[model samples]
Target chain A: MTEHPGADVVIEAQNLDLTFETNDGPVHALKDVSLTIDKGEFVSFIGPSGCGKTTFLRCIAALEQPTGGSLSVNGMTPDEARRNRAYGYVFQAAGLYPWRTIARNIKLPLEIMGYSRSEQEERVNNVLQLVDLEGFGGKYPWQLSGGMQQRASIARALAFDADILLMDEPFGALDEIVRDHLNEQLLALWARTEKTIGFVTHSIPEAVYLSTKIVVMSPRPGRITDVIDSPLPKERPLDIRDTPEFIEVAHRVREGLRAGHSE
Target chain B: MKQVLAVLTVVAVIIAFWYAASVPMNIRGVLVEAERAGEVVDPPKAADRRQIDEFELILDNPFAIDDTWEQERPRLPAPHQVAEELWDTTVEKKITSKRSLVYHAWVTLSATLLGFAFGTGLGILLAVGIVHSKVMDMSVMPWAIVSQTIPIIALAPMIIVVLYSVGVQGIIPKAVISAYLSFFPVVVGMVKGLRSPDMMQLDLLRTYGASKAQGFWKLRLPASMPYLFASLKIGIAASLVGAIVGELPTGAVAGLGARLLAGSYYGQTVQIWSALFGAAILAACLVGLLGLIERAVLKRMGMA
Candidate 1:
């Protein structure tokens, strides 16, 4: 393991292991999983179910405790980083509090983080605009379409302006067309914000298209099988999926998944 | 329009059933009165009249059936008799008068509302404690359950006696009993309500590094609204029962329960039925009011 010269590492995990003790027996959710995510990088963890992809993301957000390993965010413990408001996490579901309107839901983190009334408003408006949900702020989550609800949730995560954004299949529940549109919007938001994003996804195309680096993982003692640095340029159009480089990366990820399952 | 018609249809059926039942129930008393009035009596002797069935007497004397529904101090008062008593006591009598059903109802309602307030407050507090602390969950929840197992009828007298010894008479003792009955449902329902937030929602709050208090106010509290309203409806009904029961042991001079006791002592079946109806109507109004508020609050919160 070597660091890229002058690259600012945002997250580092070494020999990470988490075994959940159940009635059946000990389930090894993650075993000796090691990865590093750097600043301004779009890193996607792609794998089948129970592959520790979401588990690893949860570990970064300090929502899970690693049993036997060192994991750090910006050189601080994940818990400390969490306390310092270092990252914003988006769940698979939109999870916008149905009782709150879009604007209020976005302001929830700001309110929790002790942002001033004026600043909360401003940030909520800015993120709503960024997610292309500017006018729908006052509408309740149920009033919005599924895609729009998810965008509102994204706006919520972005409102606090954390340096790291951890998303666990944020668009997994949406239709392909809606997913594609959200993907494009997400990329535009990432480029503008320059936030290091850690995305978990099951779709190889989604991983290959949006991520700067794709970490392919395997299940049953979950660990990384392959790490592919995408050769596609930062500015990706939906048509870029047709490119040879995109196909090549997708092929490698598929191979890694197959190889893991064969073990 | 359809709902109103459905309710009216049900009420009409019940009233018709009541009117029919009144004939058989009051026939004996009506026959005895008919004999006293020197009407054509079967067997022409009081001792022989007792041997024959009231239905047989009614068959022999068809004219006596009309008087059955208007009997004074009959075994089962007719629906109209109870309704007339209710109207006379509530509308004809002054509210301040001891004979007024409104005065008695106000007495019972005050204790019910007071007890409900105390019960709801204590229940919510206990639920918060039970939800937040493992010690309370383990230690207090079982005791709360045990408290409910004790028959309130048996407990009501003891509660009154204990309160009287301490110079705490009047509404407080009754309110305490009401609170006792109402708090259990709230504790159980609220524990469930407070714990209703899913792992994802809780984890979302954790990711923001939210404190327990913040999580409670922003997440758990609002999420529990529907459950809270559900528990409150049950709690209020229980409170009303508690208030009535509490009145019984205390020998309360003014309350629906007291009216029932007095009516039974005097064999005034109409008065007892009217008091029972009053309590039922009051409970319905209270529960209905809670349902309305639940709708309004949940609608405002966008959960309705």
Candidate 2:
């Protein structure tokens, strides 16, 4: 892992720490967090609430500033990378503006980045199709169902065509059936786009099913306890989770979480 | 259609009550006049004759009910009497004539519209400042609340006197008063609206590297649309009231407030009622126009 091919590191964090100063005192959100994500990798940060998985994702997006250690994205500081439009972020909630139609909502980042009218229209159309939300562009966020709204939000994140997609529990609020369907679609999306994806989730099965590299974390001064690289091939299907190898990886993630808790 | 019918029903009930009230309110003066004219030879015992006398008056003069509704100086003028006066002073008279209600209305409306514009602009600026700066939020917000506590009636005379002494008389002083009343709602609404975006939404913008200006224009301002319209409705009504109040102290010969003062001095209850209704109708029109604009804007934004 230490000798991972040079120049392939898309995200490198060393001893990253973030302590939030509150009225009660200081709460350590992340401590001694270190990881290296390679290009085109689908990495999942799996932990319980307060484990700082979201916090870490926020840090990579430059939404939260790390207090200690070094973190870089695309060989630039997180802030610099953010300024360069290095990634697209999806929040837990859909967060689509009710005042804007679905098409306009998806076109927001592109508009901010000063894309021309024709380009914005073209990209909006492309991403809407990519997310299978065609012909719903003129509808408002409230007009759509929860799953559809989440897909529209995903379409929004994809509209700008960023090389990295950072999602903070994007499907956490959906029902199990909807979530499974979205997970499969996400895998297919990653296969087509080949974008570096950083996904945060609390579901064990979801993390194992979707991620190539799973970072298991623990709370009480949050830190990564295990980094598991899957032995499964890139060509994955919904049935892959039923394989013995998949069970072994899931077991390892569970043991890592338990061991961290015991210590 | 249903809403219009409901409003008509309410108006009809109010008119009926007004006519009934005018009979009792004007009967005393009418009876005194009758006694002075020797029409009632000898006054009967007050308690015994009350019902009988009232019946007799109605029987003797079939026009008594009509007379009650058409008195020149009634204590409570009947709705038809007010409506007649409104018609004579608005449609019968030329629009440019000094005696016309339309001319007076225009004077008051001009002040109201100008004051509303100034107040809304200033309020939005202050709200943006208050939202972005903690110092402004802590300092200006409390002072704004304190300002509203001082009655406009008390403030109006003083403001008029001060402005007159400084040679800033006429429409400007009245507009200043209107502005003073209208700005508070705008400030409160805009402040709330500007801060309406949730933490996740703000963070989402931040992740996109959006500047503060971009955040305000795209997110905060758009989110504030419903709030701004709500406050504008309140602000415009307050401004009309302010303009009328401003006219009272100045003793102007034009505008709705001056008409009210003249009616009171001459004991012309019908005229006063007409002016009051005129102001009400004017306020309704302003607020109704704003509602239409709100619908159009919100619908375009996909928020309706």
Candidate 3:
């Protein structure tokens, strides 16, 4: 996650700050945070619950306004980028509209973008196959397992083929086995799509395994405590978790998280 | 099937109670009328003029049960009399006849449907306003609540009078009252339904850069279907009641309410009971239609 001199910058944050004014007082959620994500880079933000990892991701997606400083997505304001459909966001929960079938849920963005009916169908089928949920298009989200539902949510985000993916705790709710399986599948998906990813999670192993860059953040006046450039290679297998290099990256992420908590 | 059986059992028990209660309620009237008709006009002979309590006369009468069921001006009509009256008016009489229950029910039904449509549209519009704007939520919602506090019974006459003065007569005034009674439930239910999507869901839509109109059509409106149908059920029943109440103050001799008024004036308890049953049946049919539509729509939407 060292800055690649020639790599195109997809997302940039410069002295970004977001403070929420509560009834008690002003709660500084993000203070003077700055980061740059290059094209095709998978960046993971790891920290405690109150840390502004999710907040920062939301700010990038234009779901939340930064109280101060400048943040840009695709060299434009977040709001403008959002309007341009620069990114696909996968939330912590599947957040599928229960009223719609899996195929219809995937087609939602395409429908909003006013794609042709045939194009929407083709994209839905493609994304469903991409997520390994081809036949599940007709089924409802409740009929699927939690892992499958999350995958469907991912498919929904991938439906319109955006350049960037912002995933907030997409696999945090899954058990370890499903998490591992999904992690491998996610890496494969990322390699195939080559989209810039901004992932938020609390698990050190997940961050270490999936990310080229890991951002460790602190709570209270939420700030970035450490930004580790992972030295592990890009082609990660499920068994790589047992290797020494993977363990070393995970240890660094853990130490960084601990340092954030201690501050 | 089990729910139907339970409902049928309750209906049977109620009919049994109604039959039993009608005997007591109609007996005093029957006894007085019979005594007047059979007034011992001829002076009783010494053997027949025994001292007895006033209750002893009714107790001694063997045909009191038959008389109670057949009284022309009964205080409370027997169940069979009410049933016969309903069947005769609804089936034997022509549907277009003024005396027919079907004709009167249609009159009331038209008003109920018109008012229900108006209320539902108004409620949805207001709910959208309340959800999207702080000003409407703070200002209009309180007034909507306060509007319900004024009893429909007290307000119906004034609404009729005011409408009559402005040359708005008959169905319009009744429909207005029906709308007044029905709108509150729709507003409350729809406001809740429009806001039903959780923070994650809203944020997900925002991340997609969905406009307010798009968000409403895709998320809010579909999400509110169940709540809207539930409110419509309540609202339809209220609308029917409003229509009947609307008929009462206007002195119209057409709808079921007019039947009730005429029955009361002429002391025809059976007619009054028939009109009441007619109104009840109309409300049930309206609500049942809504339920069917709800099931079809919700199932089609994959929510059921």
A116 in model 2: Cα distance from truth in Å? 3.1
Clashing pairs in 2: none
Sort by TM-score, best first: 1, 3, 2
lDDT of 1 at B94: 100
DockQ, Cα level, model 3: 0.78
| Candidate 1 Cα misplacement greater than 4 A, ranges | none
lDDT of 2 by residue, A214-245 (tens): 99999989999999998888888899999999
Q: For each of the candidates, what fraction of the native contacts does it recover?
A: 0.88, 0.88, 0.88
Quantify how close model 3 is to the true structure by its C-alpha RMSD in Å.
3.4
Report the lDDT tens digits of candidate 3 across residue range B86-160.
999999999999999999999998998899889888998999999999999999999999999999989999998
DockQ of each: 0.88, 0.82, 0.78
lDDT of 3 by residue, A1-263 (tens): 23657889999998999999999999999999989889999999999999999999999999899999999899999999989999999988998999999999999989888899999999999999898998999998889999999999999999989999999999989999999999999999999999999999988889989999999998988899889888889998777889998898888878887887776
- Residue-level lDDT of model 2, residues B180-289, one tens digit each, is 99999999999999999999999888877788999999999999999999999999999999999999988767999999999999998888989999999999999999
Q: List the residue pairs that clash in candidate 3.
A: none
RMSD of each predicted structure: 1.4, 3.1, 3.4
